[model samples]
Target: MKRLFAVMLIILLAGSMVFAGGKKESGTIKIAVAGPHSGDLASYGLPTVKAAEIMVEKINAEGGLLGRQVELVIEDDVCKPEVATNTAAKIVGEGVVAVIGHICSGATKAAMGIYNDSKILAISPSATNPALTQSGDYPNFFRTIASDDAQARIEVDFALDTLGLTKIAVLHDKGDYGKGLAEFAQKFLEADSRAEVVLFEGVTPGAVDYTAVINKIKNSGADGIIFGGYHPEASKIVSQMKKRAMDIPFISDDGVKDNTFIKVAGDYAEGVYASGPMDTTTNPLTIQATKEHQEKYGEDPGAFYLNAYAALQAVFNAIEVAGSTDYDAVTNALRTSYVETTLGKIKFDSKGDAEGVGFSMYQVQNGVYVELK
Candidate 1:
C-alpha cells in the first residue's frame, strides 16, 4: 500500500509541473507603444497609437497570439531625447517585452541603449536615423521605415535626374534626425559633382519666424532648397519663401509627410515636394488595413501607420516563432524570420534594418498631398 501511494504522489507532482508551465506560457502579452503622443509632433504619434490599437483588436479577434489577449500601454515620450530616456526606463521597469516607438530618431537613439542592455525588443515605425541601426550598438532595435540614407539618395536622384535642379541649399533643425539627413544630402549631393550644395545651415526648431533663414536661401542663389526637419518648421520656411514670392522647388524628407505641412504652408504648399515612406496602397493587406482603420478610427491612416502596424506585427511574429515570451528567444527568432506584413514581405538584416528600402514622392496639389510617380 505504501508503494502504491508513492506512485500516485509522483504522478500528481508531474501533472502540477506541466500545469504551472502552461500557465506561464505566452499569455496576456503587453506591449508599450511609446512615442511623442502629446507634443508638437502629436500628429505623428496619434496615428502610430491608432494603428497599433487597430492591429491589436484584429489580433484579439483572431483569438490573440499564443491564446493570449494582448494589451497595449501607451507611453508618451513627447519626442524629446531626455524624456525618451526616462520613458524607456519606465517601460523597462513596467515589464514590457517590446516597444513600438519613440518616433523621432533622437528619442529612439536615447531610449535604445536601455532596451539593448535589458534585451528588450524595439521596432520603430518612423525613426529614420541611419546610425540608430547602422552603428550596431543596439542589437534589439529595429525600424520598419527606411533609414535617412535611403531617403537622401532618393531626394538627390530626383533633384539631379528628374528636376535637373543643381544649385541646392540644405537646412536642418540641428536635431539628430534633421542634422543627419541634411549632412547626408550635402555629402551625396557634393559627391556626385553634377550638383552644387550652395548652402548648408541649421535653424532653431521652435522659432516663431524664419525670415532670417529665408533671406539666407534667397541670397545663396539656390534654385532649390532641401529642409531636413519636421513639418512645422519646414512649413514655416516654405511659407516665408512664399511671402518673398519665392516659388522654388522646396524638397524635404519624411519628417514633412503629414498633412500638417500642407495646412501650415497654405497655398505655398502647391509646389513643395516631400519624400515619404513607401506607398503601400498597392498591397492587398495595406488596403484592408486602411479600410479597417477608417472603420474603427473614423479616419484614414497616416503615411506612417502601415509601418507602425507592421512593427507590432513583427514583434508578435517573433513571439509566436519563439513559442514563448522569452526576450532572447524572440530577439533571435526576429533576426531569422521573414515577416509578410502590410508592407509586404520584409526581413531584417544583422543591424535590424529592413532588407530593402523604398520611398514615395509627394507634391502638394490643390492644397492636398498628391502622390507623384
Candidate 2:
C-alpha cells in the first residue's frame, strides 16, 4: 500500500509541473510604448502611442506570434528626460520584450543608459538628433525616420538652390533635437555653399511672448529664416513675425509638420515651408489604418503615427524571426533582418541604426500641408 501511494504522489507532482510550464509558455508578450501622453508636446507623443496601439491590434488580430497575444503597456514620460528615464526603468521592470518611445531626442538620450543596461531594444519613431545614433553605447537603439543631418541637408539644398537664398537666419529652442539640427543646418549652409547665417539665436520653448526674437530676425537683413523646434514655439514666433511685418520666408524641419501648428498659428502658418518624412496619408495602407483610427478614437492621426507604426512593425517582425522573447535573440534578429513596413523596407546597420533615408518638403497652402514636388 505504501509503495502504491508513493508512485501516485510522484505522478501527480510531475503533472502539476507540466501544467505550470505550459501556463508560463502561453503568457502574453508585452511591449512597452512610452511617450508624452500629456504635456506641451502631447500632440506628437500621443499620436505615437496611438500608432503603436494600432500596430499591436493588427498584429494580435492576425493571429498573435508564437500563439500568444501581444500586449502594449503605455507610460507617459511627459516629454521630459528625467521622466523618460524613470518610465523606461519601470517598463523594463515589467519584463517587456522591447520599448517604443521617448519621441524627443533629449528624452531618448536620457533613457538610453537604462535601456542599454537592461538589454531591451528601444526603437524611436520621431527622435532625430544625429547624436542619438552616433553614440556607440546605444546598440539597442533604432529609428524609422531619417536623421536631422539628412533633413538639414535637404532643407539647405532647397533654400540655396531652389529658393536661391544666400543670406539666412537660424533659430532653435536649445533642446537636443532643436539645437542639434540648428547647428547642423548652420554649418552645412555656411560651409557647403555660399549661403550665410546672418543671425543665430536661441529661444525658450513654451514661451508666451516672442516679439523681441521676431524683431531681431527682422532686423538681421536675412532673406530666409529657418526654425528648429516644434509647432508651438514655431507658430508663436511666426505669428509674431507677421504681426511685426517681418516678411522673410520661413522654413523649418519635421518638428513643425502637424495640424496643431496650423491650428495654433491660424492663417499665420501660411507660406511656411517645412521638410520631413513623406506623409503617411499618401500611402494606401496608412490611409486605411488612419481612417480606422479616427473611427475608433474620433480624431485624425498626427504626423508621427506612420513612423511609430513602422517602428512597432519592426519590433514584432524581430520577435517573429527570433521565435522567442529572449532579449539577445530579438536583438540579433533586429540587427540582421529587414522588415517591410508602411514606411518602407527597414533594415538596421551594424550599429543598430536605419540605413540612409531622406525627407520631403511641404508647404502650407490654404490651411493644408501640400507636398512640394
Candidate 3:
C-alpha cells in the first residue's frame, strides 16, 4: 500500500507538469496592432485594426501560424509620442510576439526603443521617417512603406521638373514626421539649382487659424508650397490659402494625401498636389484585400489600409517560415524571405524599407486623388 501511494503521487505530479506545459505551448500567439485608433487621426489607425481582424480571421481559417490561433493585442496611441510609450509598454506586458503599428512617425519613434529592448519585432505600415531604419539603432524594426526622404525626392522632383515651380515655400507642422519630411524637401530643393526654397518655416499644429502663415507664403513670392504635415493641418492651411485667393499650387507630402484631407477641406482640396505611395490597386492581392474589407466592413478601407494588411501578412509569414517566434529567427526570416503582399512580391532591405515600394505624385481633382501619370 505504501509503494502504491508513492507511485500515484509521482504520476499526479507528472500529469500536472504535462498539463501546464501543454497550456503554455498551446496558447494563442499574440500580435499587437498599435496606432491612433481614436482622436482626429482615427482614420489612419482603424483600418489597421480592421485589417488585423480580417487577417486574423483568414489566418485562423487557414490553420493559423504554427498550428496556434493568432490573436491581436490592439491598442491606440492617438498618434501622440507620450501615449505611444505607454502603449508600447502595454503591448510588451501583453506578451505579444510581434507588433504592426504606431502609424505616425513620432509615435513609432517613441515606441521603438521599448520594442528593441524587449526584442520584439515591429513592422510599420506608414512610419516613413528615414531615421527609423537608417539610424542603425533598431535592427528589429521594419516597414512596408517608403521613407520620407524618398517621398521628399518625389515631391521635389514633381515640383521642379513636372510642375515647373521654381520658388517654393517649405512649411511644416514642427512635429517629428512633418519636420523630417519638410527638412528633406528643403534639402532636395536647395540642392537643385533649378529651384529655390523661398521660405522654410514651421507652423504650430491645431492652430485655429493659419492666415498669418498664409500671408508669409504670399509675401515670400513662392510659386508653390510644400507643406509637410497630416491632413487636418493641411486642410486648414489649404482652406485658408484658398480663402485668401492664393492658389500658387499647394504641393505637400503623403501626410496630406489621405482622403480625409479632401473631405475636410472640401472644394479647397482641389488642385492640391501631394506625394504618396505608388498605387498598387491593379495588383490581384490588392483587389482581393479590398473586396474582403468592403464585404466585411461595409466601406472602403482607409489610409494605409493595404500597407497595414501587408505588414501583418509579412509578420505572420516570417513566423511561419522561421517555425518559431524567437525574435532573431522571425526577423531573419523577414529579411531573407520574400512575401507576396498587397504591394506585390517584396521583401525588406537592410535598412528596413520595403523593396519596390515608392512614391507617386497625385492631384486632388474632382474631389478624388488622381495619380499623376
Q: How much lDDT does each candidate structure score?
A: 0.86, 0.84, 0.91
Return whichever of 1 and 3 wins on lDDT: 3
Which stretches of candidate 1 lie above 4 Å from their native place? 1-26, 154-182, 185-277, 360-373
Give the RMSD in angstroms, all C-alphas superposed, for model 2.
8.0
Report the lDDT of model 1 for residue 198.
Answer: 92
User: What is the descending lDDT order?
Assistant: 3, 1, 2
Angstrom error at residue 162, model 1: 15
Candidate No. with top TM-score: 3
Which residue pairs collide in model 1, if any?
none
Tens digit per residue, CA lDDT, model 3, 1-373: 9999999999999998897566536888999999999899999999999999999999999998899999889999999999999999999988789999879999999999999999998999999888999998999899998876998888888998888999999999999888988999999988899989999999998887998999999999999999888999999998888888888898888788999999999999999999887888799999999999999999999999999989988999999999988788899999989999999888888878888678879999999999997
**Residues 11-122, model 2: lDDT tens digits:** 9999988875565368888888888889788998988888877777887899887878988899999989989989988998777778887788999989988988988888
**Which pairs clash inside model 3?**
none
> Model 1, range 133-250, lDDT digits (tens) per residue?
8898998898888887887878888889888998999999999988988889998998998889999999998998989889988899999988898999888888788888988898
Q: What is the lDDT of candidate 1?
A: 0.86
